[model samples]
Target: MVNCMKEQVFFGEGMAMVKRDYPDLYEAIVALNEAAYTGKVLDYRTQKLIAMGINAAASDERATKKQMISAIKEFGVTKDEIVDVLRVVLLTSGMPPFTKGMKILGEVMEK
Candidate 1:
Protein backbone atom coordinates (compact mmCIF):
# COMPACT_ATOMS: atom_id res chain seq x y z
CA MET A 1 0.00 0.00 0.00
CA VAL A 2 1.12 3.55 -0.62
CA ASN A 3 2.18 5.12 2.60
CA CYS A 4 1.08 8.69 1.93
CA MET A 5 2.68 9.90 5.12
CA LYS A 6 6.06 8.59 4.03
CA GLU A 7 6.29 7.96 0.30
CA GLN A 8 5.02 11.29 -1.06
CA VAL A 9 3.22 13.91 0.96
CA PHE A 10 0.25 15.44 -0.80
CA PHE A 11 1.23 18.75 0.80
CA GLY A 12 3.14 21.19 -1.39
CA GLU A 13 6.67 22.50 -0.85
CA GLY A 14 5.37 25.53 1.00
CA MET A 15 3.41 23.24 3.29
CA ALA A 16 6.43 21.03 3.80
CA MET A 17 8.37 24.07 4.88
CA VAL A 18 5.45 25.02 7.08
CA LYS A 19 5.90 21.78 9.00
CA ARG A 20 9.20 23.10 10.27
CA ASP A 21 8.50 26.79 10.10
CA TYR A 22 5.20 26.70 11.98
CA PRO A 23 5.03 23.68 14.19
CA ASP A 24 1.69 24.41 15.85
CA LEU A 25 -0.20 25.04 12.64
CA TYR A 26 1.41 22.06 10.97
CA GLU A 27 0.48 19.78 13.83
CA ALA A 28 -3.13 20.84 13.61
CA ILE A 29 -3.16 20.14 9.90
CA VAL A 30 -1.62 16.75 10.41
CA ALA A 31 -4.18 15.87 13.01
CA LEU A 32 -6.91 17.01 10.71
CA ASN A 33 -5.55 14.88 7.91
CA GLU A 34 -5.47 11.81 10.13
CA ALA A 35 -8.98 12.42 11.33
CA ALA A 36 -10.28 12.96 7.84
CA TYR A 37 -8.79 9.71 6.60
CA THR A 38 -9.99 7.59 9.44
CA GLY A 39 -12.85 6.52 7.16
CA LYS A 40 -16.17 6.01 8.87
CA VAL A 41 -17.67 4.17 5.92
CA LEU A 42 -15.76 4.41 2.63
CA ASP A 43 -12.54 2.49 2.52
CA TYR A 44 -9.25 4.32 2.32
CA ARG A 45 -8.76 3.14 -1.26
CA THR A 46 -12.06 4.66 -2.35
CA GLN A 47 -11.34 7.83 -0.42
CA LYS A 48 -7.94 8.08 -2.01
CA LEU A 49 -9.42 7.73 -5.47
CA ILE A 50 -11.95 10.42 -4.66
CA ALA A 51 -9.11 12.59 -3.47
CA MET A 52 -7.38 12.02 -6.81
CA GLY A 53 -10.50 13.25 -8.56
CA ILE A 54 -10.66 16.29 -6.29
CA ASN A 55 -7.05 17.10 -6.97
CA ALA A 56 -7.62 16.72 -10.67
CA ALA A 57 -10.65 18.94 -10.48
CA ALA A 58 -8.62 21.52 -8.62
CA SER A 59 -6.22 21.56 -11.61
CA ASP A 60 -3.24 20.85 -9.44
CA GLU A 61 -1.09 18.97 -11.89
CA ARG A 62 1.53 17.90 -9.39
CA ALA A 63 -0.87 16.59 -6.74
CA THR A 64 -3.11 14.94 -9.31
CA LYS A 65 -0.19 13.10 -10.82
CA LYS A 66 1.06 11.98 -7.45
CA GLN A 67 -2.34 10.80 -6.32
CA MET A 68 -2.91 8.88 -9.53
CA ILE A 69 0.44 7.15 -9.27
CA SER A 70 -0.10 6.35 -5.65
CA ALA A 71 -3.58 4.95 -6.27
CA ILE A 72 -2.27 2.62 -8.94
CA LYS A 73 0.89 1.55 -7.13
CA GLU A 74 -0.78 1.03 -3.79
CA PHE A 75 -4.35 -0.01 -4.42
CA GLY A 76 -4.26 -1.13 -8.04
CA VAL A 77 -6.97 1.34 -9.03
CA THR A 78 -7.83 0.73 -12.68
CA LYS A 79 -7.76 3.06 -15.67
CA ASP A 80 -11.52 2.69 -16.04
CA GLU A 81 -12.05 3.89 -12.49
CA ILE A 82 -9.94 6.95 -13.19
CA VAL A 83 -11.94 7.61 -16.33
CA ASP A 84 -15.10 7.56 -14.27
CA VAL A 85 -13.58 10.13 -11.95
CA LEU A 86 -12.63 12.25 -14.95
CA ARG A 87 -16.22 12.15 -16.12
CA VAL A 88 -17.17 13.87 -12.88
CA VAL A 89 -14.37 16.36 -13.37
CA LEU A 90 -15.67 17.10 -16.85
CA LEU A 91 -19.11 17.87 -15.52
CA THR A 92 -18.24 19.92 -12.45
CA SER A 93 -14.77 21.26 -13.08
CA GLY A 94 -14.81 21.84 -16.87
CA MET A 95 -12.72 20.70 -19.79
CA PRO A 96 -9.36 22.05 -18.78
CA PRO A 97 -9.19 19.99 -15.62
CA PHE A 98 -10.67 16.95 -17.31
CA THR A 99 -8.21 17.29 -20.14
CA LYS A 100 -5.28 17.74 -17.81
CA GLY A 101 -6.46 14.83 -15.69
CA MET A 102 -6.72 12.58 -18.73
CA LYS A 103 -3.24 13.61 -19.79
CA ILE A 104 -1.85 12.93 -16.34
CA LEU A 105 -3.67 9.60 -16.12
CA GLY A 106 -2.21 8.52 -19.42
CA GLU A 107 1.27 9.46 -18.32
CA VAL A 108 0.98 7.69 -14.99
CA MET A 109 -0.49 4.52 -16.52
CA GLU A 110 2.11 4.36 -19.25
CA LYS A 111 4.76 4.01 -16.61
Candidate 2:
Protein backbone atom coordinates (compact mmCIF):
# COMPACT_ATOMS: atom_id res chain seq x y z
CA MET A 1 0.00 0.00 0.00
CA VAL A 2 1.08 3.54 -0.65
CA ASN A 3 2.46 5.39 2.37
CA CYS A 4 0.17 8.38 2.67
CA MET A 5 2.23 10.01 5.39
CA LYS A 6 5.36 9.85 3.27
CA GLU A 7 3.70 11.77 0.45
CA GLN A 8 2.18 14.49 2.59
CA VAL A 9 3.11 17.60 0.58
CA PHE A 10 0.75 20.05 2.13
CA PHE A 11 2.39 22.71 4.26
CA GLY A 12 5.61 22.08 2.29
CA GLU A 13 7.68 25.00 3.51
CA GLY A 14 5.48 25.71 6.52
CA MET A 15 5.63 22.28 8.19
CA ALA A 16 9.19 22.66 9.37
CA MET A 17 8.36 25.94 11.07
CA VAL A 18 5.25 24.45 12.60
CA LYS A 19 7.09 21.37 13.78
CA ARG A 20 9.67 23.51 15.48
CA ASP A 21 7.07 25.67 17.22
CA TYR A 22 4.09 23.35 17.71
CA PRO A 23 5.31 19.81 17.81
CA ASP A 24 2.41 18.60 19.95
CA LEU A 25 -0.27 19.79 17.54
CA TYR A 26 1.54 18.34 14.56
CA GLU A 27 1.88 14.99 16.31
CA ALA A 28 -1.79 15.10 17.25
CA ILE A 29 -2.84 15.65 13.67
CA VAL A 30 -0.64 12.77 12.51
CA ALA A 31 -2.07 10.50 15.17
CA LEU A 32 -5.56 11.56 14.28
CA ASN A 33 -5.03 10.79 10.62
CA GLU A 34 -3.67 7.35 11.42
CA ALA A 35 -6.35 6.48 13.94
CA ALA A 36 -9.17 7.89 11.88
CA TYR A 37 -8.12 6.00 8.78
CA THR A 38 -7.35 2.69 10.46
CA GLY A 39 -10.15 2.07 12.94
CA LYS A 40 -13.28 -0.06 12.87
CA VAL A 41 -15.81 2.77 12.82
CA LEU A 42 -14.68 3.40 9.25
CA ASP A 43 -12.00 1.59 7.30
CA TYR A 44 -9.39 3.50 5.38
CA ARG A 45 -11.30 3.35 2.12
CA THR A 46 -14.53 4.59 3.65
CA GLN A 47 -12.68 7.27 5.56
CA LYS A 48 -11.17 8.46 2.31
CA LEU A 49 -14.59 8.59 0.69
CA ILE A 50 -15.98 10.66 3.51
CA ALA A 51 -12.90 12.89 3.58
CA MET A 52 -13.18 13.45 -0.17
CA GLY A 53 -16.81 14.46 0.23
CA ILE A 54 -15.99 16.95 2.97
CA ASN A 55 -12.91 18.33 1.21
CA ALA A 56 -14.67 18.69 -2.10
CA ALA A 57 -17.32 20.73 -0.36
CA ALA A 58 -14.84 22.95 1.46
CA SER A 59 -13.59 26.32 0.12
CA ASP A 60 -9.86 25.56 0.30
CA GLU A 61 -8.67 23.99 -2.91
CA ARG A 62 -5.12 23.30 -1.74
CA ALA A 63 -6.24 21.40 1.33
CA THR A 64 -8.87 19.57 -0.68
CA LYS A 65 -6.39 18.48 -3.35
CA LYS A 66 -3.89 17.33 -0.78
CA GLN A 67 -6.44 15.29 1.12
CA MET A 68 -7.88 13.88 -2.10
CA ILE A 69 -4.49 12.68 -3.30
CA SER A 70 -3.74 11.22 0.10
CA ALA A 71 -7.01 9.34 -0.04
CA ILE A 72 -6.35 8.14 -3.55
CA LYS A 73 -2.89 6.81 -2.81
CA GLU A 74 -3.47 5.53 0.71
CA PHE A 75 -6.99 4.23 0.44
CA GLY A 76 -6.97 3.33 -3.22
CA VAL A 77 -9.84 5.65 -4.06
CA THR A 78 -10.31 6.30 -7.73
CA LYS A 79 -10.70 9.52 -9.69
CA ASP A 80 -14.32 8.56 -10.34
CA GLU A 81 -15.01 8.60 -6.60
CA ILE A 82 -13.49 12.05 -6.23
CA VAL A 83 -15.49 13.32 -9.20
CA ASP A 84 -18.65 11.81 -7.74
CA VAL A 85 -18.12 13.69 -4.50
CA LEU A 86 -17.58 16.89 -6.46
CA ARG A 87 -20.82 16.25 -8.30
CA VAL A 88 -22.66 16.01 -5.01
CA VAL A 89 -20.91 19.12 -3.77
CA LEU A 90 -22.12 20.91 -6.87
CA LEU A 91 -25.70 20.02 -6.03
CA THR A 92 -25.46 21.32 -2.48
CA SER A 93 -22.97 24.19 -2.73
CA GLY A 94 -23.77 25.23 -6.30
CA MET A 95 -21.59 24.99 -9.39
CA PRO A 96 -18.96 27.72 -8.97
CA PRO A 97 -17.07 26.33 -5.98
CA PHE A 98 -17.49 22.80 -7.20
CA THR A 99 -16.03 23.74 -10.57
CA LYS A 100 -12.96 25.19 -8.90
CA GLY A 101 -12.60 22.09 -6.73
CA MET A 102 -12.95 19.86 -9.76
CA LYS A 103 -10.19 21.71 -11.55
CA ILE A 104 -7.88 21.43 -8.58
CA LEU A 105 -8.63 17.77 -8.01
CA GLY A 106 -8.16 17.08 -11.72
CA GLU A 107 -4.75 18.67 -11.60
CA VAL A 108 -3.72 16.64 -8.56
CA MET A 109 -4.87 13.39 -10.12
CA GLU A 110 -3.01 14.22 -13.30
CA LYS A 111 0.25 14.51 -11.37
Candidate 3:
Protein backbone atom coordinates (compact mmCIF):
# COMPACT_ATOMS: atom_id res chain seq x y z
CA MET A 1 0.00 0.00 0.00
CA VAL A 2 1.05 3.56 -0.53
CA ASN A 3 0.18 6.80 1.21
CA CYS A 4 -0.71 9.51 -1.23
CA MET A 5 -1.64 12.23 1.19
CA LYS A 6 -0.80 15.74 0.20
CA GLU A 7 0.95 18.14 2.55
CA GLN A 8 -1.84 20.66 2.25
CA VAL A 9 -5.55 20.45 1.67
CA PHE A 10 -7.45 23.56 0.69
CA PHE A 11 -9.63 24.55 3.65
CA GLY A 12 -12.92 24.42 1.80
CA GLU A 13 -13.87 23.37 -1.71
CA GLY A 14 -16.75 25.83 -1.85
CA MET A 15 -14.46 28.56 -0.69
CA ALA A 16 -11.81 27.59 -3.19
CA MET A 17 -14.33 27.56 -5.99
CA VAL A 18 -15.61 30.90 -4.88
CA LYS A 19 -12.07 32.14 -4.76
CA ARG A 20 -11.57 31.09 -8.36
CA ASP A 21 -14.87 32.38 -9.65
CA TYR A 22 -15.43 35.28 -7.29
CA PRO A 23 -12.47 36.83 -5.59
CA ASP A 24 -14.68 38.96 -3.35
CA LEU A 25 -16.25 36.00 -1.58
CA TYR A 26 -12.82 34.41 -1.31
CA GLU A 27 -11.48 37.47 0.46
CA ALA A 28 -14.19 37.29 3.10
CA ILE A 29 -13.52 33.58 3.60
CA VAL A 30 -9.78 34.10 3.86
CA ALA A 31 -10.33 36.81 6.43
CA LEU A 32 -12.61 34.49 8.34
CA ASN A 33 -10.06 31.72 8.27
CA GLU A 34 -7.38 34.04 9.48
CA ALA A 35 -9.52 35.49 12.25
CA ALA A 36 -10.80 32.10 13.30
CA TYR A 37 -7.34 30.60 13.67
CA THR A 38 -5.87 33.52 15.55
CA GLY A 39 -5.77 31.84 18.98
CA LYS A 40 -6.61 34.81 21.16
CA VAL A 41 -7.11 32.60 24.20
CA LEU A 42 -6.82 28.90 23.22
CA ASP A 43 -3.72 29.03 21.02
CA TYR A 44 -3.57 27.76 17.44
CA ARG A 45 -2.63 24.16 18.20
CA THR A 46 -5.42 23.75 20.69
CA GLN A 47 -7.85 25.31 18.27
CA LYS A 48 -6.72 22.90 15.59
CA LEU A 49 -7.33 19.94 17.86
CA ILE A 50 -10.76 21.24 18.72
CA ALA A 51 -11.47 21.54 15.02
CA MET A 52 -10.31 17.96 14.63
CA GLY A 53 -12.72 16.76 17.28
CA ILE A 54 -15.57 18.83 15.86
CA ASN A 55 -14.94 17.40 12.41
CA ALA A 56 -15.02 13.94 13.94
CA ALA A 57 -18.21 14.69 15.80
CA ALA A 58 -19.72 15.83 12.54
CA SER A 59 -18.49 12.60 10.89
CA ASP A 60 -16.53 14.61 8.43
CA GLU A 61 -13.90 12.11 7.35
CA ARG A 62 -11.97 14.27 4.91
CA ALA A 63 -11.69 17.30 7.18
CA THR A 64 -10.84 15.14 10.16
CA LYS A 65 -8.04 13.43 8.29
CA LYS A 66 -6.72 16.72 7.02
CA GLN A 67 -6.72 18.17 10.50
CA MET A 68 -5.01 15.08 11.87
CA ILE A 69 -2.24 15.21 9.32
CA SER A 70 -1.83 18.95 9.62
CA ALA A 71 -1.75 18.77 13.38
CA ILE A 72 0.89 16.06 13.39
CA LYS A 73 3.10 17.76 10.83
CA GLU A 74 2.54 21.34 11.90
CA PHE A 75 2.25 21.00 15.65
CA GLY A 76 3.56 17.52 16.45
CA VAL A 77 0.17 16.51 17.79
CA THR A 78 0.43 13.08 19.39
CA LYS A 79 -1.68 9.97 18.83
CA ASP A 80 -2.59 9.81 22.47
CA GLU A 81 -3.87 13.35 22.30
CA ILE A 82 -5.91 12.53 19.24
CA VAL A 83 -7.34 9.52 21.00
CA ASP A 84 -8.30 11.77 23.83
CA VAL A 85 -10.15 14.03 21.42
CA LEU A 86 -11.93 11.02 19.93
CA ARG A 87 -12.97 9.98 23.37
CA VAL A 88 -15.02 13.15 23.52
CA VAL A 89 -16.52 12.31 20.14
CA LEU A 90 -17.41 8.86 21.41
CA LEU A 91 -19.46 10.45 24.12
CA THR A 92 -21.05 13.27 22.17
CA SER A 93 -21.07 11.97 18.61
CA GLY A 94 -21.69 8.25 19.29
CA MET A 95 -19.77 5.15 18.28
CA PRO A 96 -20.04 5.36 14.50
CA PRO A 97 -18.56 8.81 14.18
CA PHE A 98 -16.01 8.05 16.84
CA THR A 99 -14.98 4.92 15.03
CA LYS A 100 -14.82 6.76 11.75
CA GLY A 101 -12.65 9.33 13.43
CA MET A 102 -10.43 6.63 14.84
CA LYS A 103 -10.07 5.04 11.44
CA ILE A 104 -9.05 8.32 9.83
CA LEU A 105 -6.70 9.00 12.71
CA GLY A 106 -5.05 5.64 12.20
CA GLU A 107 -4.73 6.08 8.47
CA VAL A 108 -3.17 9.51 8.82
CA MET A 109 -0.95 8.37 11.65
CA GLU A 110 0.21 5.40 9.65
CA LYS A 111 1.22 7.55 6.76
Candidate 4:
Protein backbone atom coordinates (compact mmCIF):
# COMPACT_ATOMS: atom_id res chain seq x y z
CA MET A 1 0.00 0.00 0.00
CA VAL A 2 1.15 3.53 -0.68
CA ASN A 3 1.93 5.49 2.41
CA CYS A 4 -0.65 8.19 3.13
CA MET A 5 2.02 10.47 4.50
CA LYS A 6 4.01 10.20 1.28
CA GLU A 7 0.95 11.02 -0.78
CA GLN A 8 -0.19 13.97 1.35
CA VAL A 9 2.47 16.46 0.34
CA PHE A 10 2.54 15.74 -3.36
CA PHE A 11 0.43 17.37 -6.08
CA GLY A 12 -0.87 14.51 -8.12
CA GLU A 13 -4.41 15.82 -8.18
CA GLY A 14 -3.32 19.29 -9.19
CA MET A 15 -1.19 17.80 -11.90
CA ALA A 16 -4.16 15.80 -13.05
CA MET A 17 -6.18 18.98 -13.34
CA VAL A 18 -3.45 20.57 -15.39
CA LYS A 19 -3.23 17.53 -17.59
CA ARG A 20 -6.96 17.44 -18.19
CA ASP A 21 -7.18 21.14 -18.93
CA TYR A 22 -4.02 21.50 -21.00
CA PRO A 23 -2.33 18.26 -21.70
CA ASP A 24 0.47 19.38 -23.97
CA LEU A 25 1.30 22.49 -22.05
CA TYR A 26 1.04 20.72 -18.71
CA GLU A 27 3.34 17.94 -19.80
CA ALA A 28 5.84 20.39 -21.21
CA ILE A 29 5.93 22.45 -18.06
CA VAL A 30 6.22 19.39 -15.88
CA ALA A 31 9.03 18.18 -18.07
CA LEU A 32 10.75 21.52 -17.79
CA ASN A 33 10.54 21.61 -14.02
CA GLU A 34 11.72 18.03 -13.78
CA ALA A 35 14.62 18.66 -16.10
CA ALA A 36 15.63 21.84 -14.36
CA TYR A 37 15.40 20.38 -10.89
CA THR A 38 16.59 16.88 -11.73
CA GLY A 39 14.43 14.41 -9.85
CA LYS A 40 17.28 13.36 -7.58
CA VAL A 41 18.70 16.81 -6.96
CA LEU A 42 15.53 18.74 -6.25
CA ASP A 43 14.19 16.47 -3.50
CA TYR A 44 10.70 16.67 -2.00
CA ARG A 45 11.56 19.57 0.29
CA THR A 46 12.76 21.86 -2.47
CA GLN A 47 9.72 21.05 -4.60
CA LYS A 48 7.45 21.86 -1.67
CA LEU A 49 9.26 25.18 -1.14
CA ILE A 50 8.78 26.15 -4.77
CA ALA A 51 5.13 25.14 -4.62
CA MET A 52 4.60 27.21 -1.47
CA GLY A 53 6.34 30.19 -3.02
CA ILE A 54 4.22 30.00 -6.14
CA ASN A 55 1.03 29.51 -4.16
CA ALA A 56 1.86 32.51 -1.97
CA ALA A 57 2.50 34.70 -4.99
CA ALA A 58 -0.74 33.47 -6.50
CA SER A 59 -2.59 34.66 -3.35
CA ASP A 60 -3.50 31.23 -2.00
CA GLU A 61 -2.61 32.04 1.59
CA ARG A 62 -4.11 29.04 3.30
CA ALA A 63 -2.60 26.54 0.91
CA THR A 64 0.71 28.37 0.79
CA LYS A 65 1.28 28.36 4.53
CA LYS A 66 -0.02 24.85 4.91
CA GLN A 67 2.51 23.70 2.36
CA MET A 68 5.18 25.91 3.91
CA ILE A 69 4.80 24.41 7.35
CA SER A 70 4.71 20.93 5.94
CA ALA A 71 7.87 21.59 4.00
CA ILE A 72 9.46 23.00 7.12
CA LYS A 73 8.67 19.93 9.14
CA GLU A 74 9.23 17.30 6.46
CA PHE A 75 12.05 18.90 4.55
CA GLY A 76 13.72 20.99 7.20
CA VAL A 77 13.20 24.37 5.58
CA THR A 78 14.28 27.12 7.95
CA LYS A 79 12.29 30.14 9.13
CA ASP A 80 14.68 32.39 7.24
CA GLU A 81 14.03 30.46 4.07
CA ILE A 82 10.31 30.77 4.52
CA VAL A 83 10.66 34.49 5.25
CA ASP A 84 12.80 34.97 2.17
CA VAL A 85 10.21 33.25 0.03
CA LEU A 86 7.56 35.58 1.43
CA ARG A 87 9.75 38.59 0.69
CA VAL A 88 10.24 37.47 -2.87
CA VAL A 89 6.51 37.02 -3.30
CA LEU A 90 5.86 40.46 -1.85
CA LEU A 91 8.39 42.05 -4.16
CA THR A 92 7.20 40.37 -7.31
CA SER A 93 3.49 39.91 -6.74
CA GLY A 94 2.60 43.07 -4.79
CA MET A 95 1.27 43.62 -1.29
CA PRO A 96 -2.23 42.27 -1.16
CA PRO A 97 -1.40 38.67 -1.80
CA PHE A 98 1.95 38.97 -0.10
CA THR A 99 0.37 40.37 3.03
CA LYS A 100 -2.07 37.54 3.25
CA GLY A 101 0.65 34.99 2.73
CA MET A 102 2.88 36.71 5.24
CA LYS A 103 0.14 36.76 7.83
CA ILE A 104 -0.28 33.03 7.50
CA LEU A 105 3.43 32.40 7.48
CA GLY A 106 3.85 34.47 10.62
CA GLU A 107 1.11 32.60 12.40
CA VAL A 108 2.66 29.27 11.46
CA MET A 109 6.14 30.32 12.56
CA GLU A 110 5.01 31.61 15.92
CA LYS A 111 3.68 28.21 16.95
Q: 54 in model 2: Cα distance from truth in Å?
A: 1.6
RMSD of 1: 3.7
Please rank every candidate by lDDT, starting with the best: 1, 3, 4, 2
Cα displacement (Å) at residue 74, model 4: 0.2
lDDT of 2 at 22: 95
Q: 31-74, model 3: which lDDT tens digit per residue?
A: 66676667789887898888888888988787788889888988
User: TM-scores across all candidates?
Assistant: 0.88, 0.69, 0.87, 0.63
Q: Can you write out model 1's per-residue Cα lDDT over 25-90, one digit (the tens) per residue?
A: 777777767877876898789888888888888898888888888888888999999999999999
lDDT value, residue 32 of candidate 2: 56
> Model 3 — which ten-residue stretch has the worst lDDT?
1-10
TM-score of 4: 0.63
Among these predictions, the greatest lDDT belongs to: 1
| TM accuracy, model 2 | 0.69
Across residues 9-58, which tens digit of lDDT does each residue of candidate 2 receive? 33344666756799997676666556655657765567666665665676
The lDDT values for all models are 0.81, 0.68, 0.77, 0.69
Candidate 2 C-alpha RMSD relative to the actual structure? 4.7
User: Per-residue alpha-carbon lDDT of model 4 for 31-108, expressed as tens digits?
Assistant: 565555554876766766777778888877557767877877877888788878878888899998778887887898
